[model samples]
Target: MSIPPGESAPNVSTGELNARYDKFVVDLLGVIAYGELSAFERLSSDARYSPTLHDRAALGRMAVTEFEHFDVVRARLAEMNMDVELAMRPFQPSIDSFHDRTRPADWYESLMKAYVVDAISGDFYRAISEFLDQKTREVINAVQTNDESGALLQDRLKKMLADDPRLASRLALWGRRLVGEALTQAQRVGTEHSFLRGLMIEDELPAARNEVSTLLAQLTKNHSRRMSQLGLTA
Candidate 1:
């Protein structure tokens, strides 16, 4: 069932807990944990396509970073008395669908995918974290930070764009396609997962609908800014 806009998370007392909201939190953690794990796999495979030893090493480092983030989330799940792997299982279909549909065509495409997709995912997570408790929010924020790969990808793309201005249009199109597929899969997850959809409904009052609208605007703005930073048209 879905909550109306602006309804506070269900309250429980004494021996009771808000099971629905707690489940939502667990599901969020699961999605992110599995996302990181999948990222590790994808990045590792992408490294095999790197043109130079240096580039491959850089991708390898980024893969390790992804696994490290996955471990952190797994630890958090353990603290919550949840089965980490089981919790992550429900999220795999959507996350995997996103990655499978958007697999990069080459080394440059992989770099663009890493930068654009990661930034978009990060912004989306940051927006959702606002609805969570302080501890959970902190965990999500820490997991969402873009790492050295972001910087390396930005620099590489900038140089490439500078050297061949025509490449910008193609990469820009790829970025747009990435965002489109991501949104498609995101909508599927939201529809299939009631608790996740509930998180967006800030309260029961009709006026609270603005919260979701505001959130969408914020995500879009952050995305446009990142695209600009990468010297691409959003």
Candidate 2:
């Protein structure tokens, strides 16, 4: 299922909505925390594939940033008196599967994967943040700010593509594949996590369905623009 817009919880009392929203926040943070942790590991692993010492170190820096992001989310969960490990556990399998299936074949593929996939997920999180409480929104915003990996990946990929126009076709295809798998991953998470699904839609209303379609359209549009920036097809 596509992510629906941030609509009020339907057919619930204020207190009930509050409780549901709290659960939603925890679930959101849990998934994002796990994602950051996974990114840290993946980038560190991908560093070995880097063609230059400078590139390897750059990836190492990004990996550290990801872990720092993870730590921020972990602290938030702890403050909520939630078991951080338990909160992140449910998302582990699906997220791990995503990485396993999309593992890059080479340095260029790794760069594209890191850039395109991370941006898509960031967009999704920002979209969901609209309906969250002020404090939770601040936490989400804090972790996402000052991300330099996207810029680094974009610059490197652009230069690489410019030097060898032949890579455009292959990378474009890879970008599309990454988006496809990302949407699939989103669907899996939404299907499996009821509270997270509740944040997006309410009781399966038609308007809710339309909102979901709109969100998906926006994500796709943003993704296509990102691909264009990288001189690739969406």
Candidate 3:
């Protein structure tokens, strides 16, 4: 794909560029693609939990978006002379574990999990891409990485939490459960892929770890505030 002038392309000849691209870009894209592919499968199944036609359609749309993301990553992998499935193979178990462990019980829970996924992935990708060459960065940016479904979910969930205060407790508890599952999968991935796990985001290994920890802390705080704001017991 043609990127605009000045876009950073992968300079494979430059060892530093190649290292950054491989460590951060590859990892981020692979994870993004893996997540989308799994979401495509799981969200299709999860849509059944929607209690209304609109809610069902909303969930269905998320699946569609996930497929689009999968296509984007698949194409990128091809351009890099990598087989998408082979590249994704190593990550499958971790991704599968995450979705399997956090099977949503209801419409709200589904939305809550979606929100968490969106926020965390966005935070990670946006940080990881900063060090890439212009071409590589542009290509990554060109892909649809934003969590639009999460926005829709947030709007719906916020209103629901407002209407039914008790739902705040239920949803916050549900959010924690989803995050816990994701952490479990993350730990599994890190343990399994020592080299990949050491790759830093924002050019700092310590910072990335801090970002992950800090983000989790923030999510927890947000959940608590949301629960309290809705007058629900946490």
Number of the predicted model whose TM-score against the real structure is largest: 2
lDDT of 2 at 72: 91
lDDT of 2 by residue, 33-60 (tens): 9999999999999999899999999999
Ranking by lDDT: 2, 1, 3
What TM-score, to 2 decimals, does candidate 3 have? 0.73
TM-scores of all predicted structures: 0.86, 0.90, 0.73
Give the clashing residue pairs of candidate 1, or none: 5-203, 5-204, 6-202, 6-203, 6-204, 7-203, 7-204
The TM-score obtained by model 1 is 0.86
Cα deviation of 110, candidate 2, in Å: 0.5
Q: Which scores greater on TM-score, model 1 or model 3? A: 1
Clashes of each: 7, 0, 7
lDDT by residue (106-192, candidate 1, tens digit) is 888998888877887787788777767788888887787466668888897898789889888889899889877776665576557
Instruction: Quickly count the clashes in candidate 2.
Output: 0
Q: Distance from true position, residue 108, model 2, in Å?
A: 0.8
Runs with alpha carbons beyond 4 Å of true place in candidate 3: 1-24, 142-148, 187-191, 194-234
Candidate 2's C-alpha runs over 4 A off are: 1-11, 145-147, 195-204
lDDT of 3 by residue, 135-231 (tens): 6566556554454665577678778877787787677777667656655555566556642333332345566556556655665565555445444
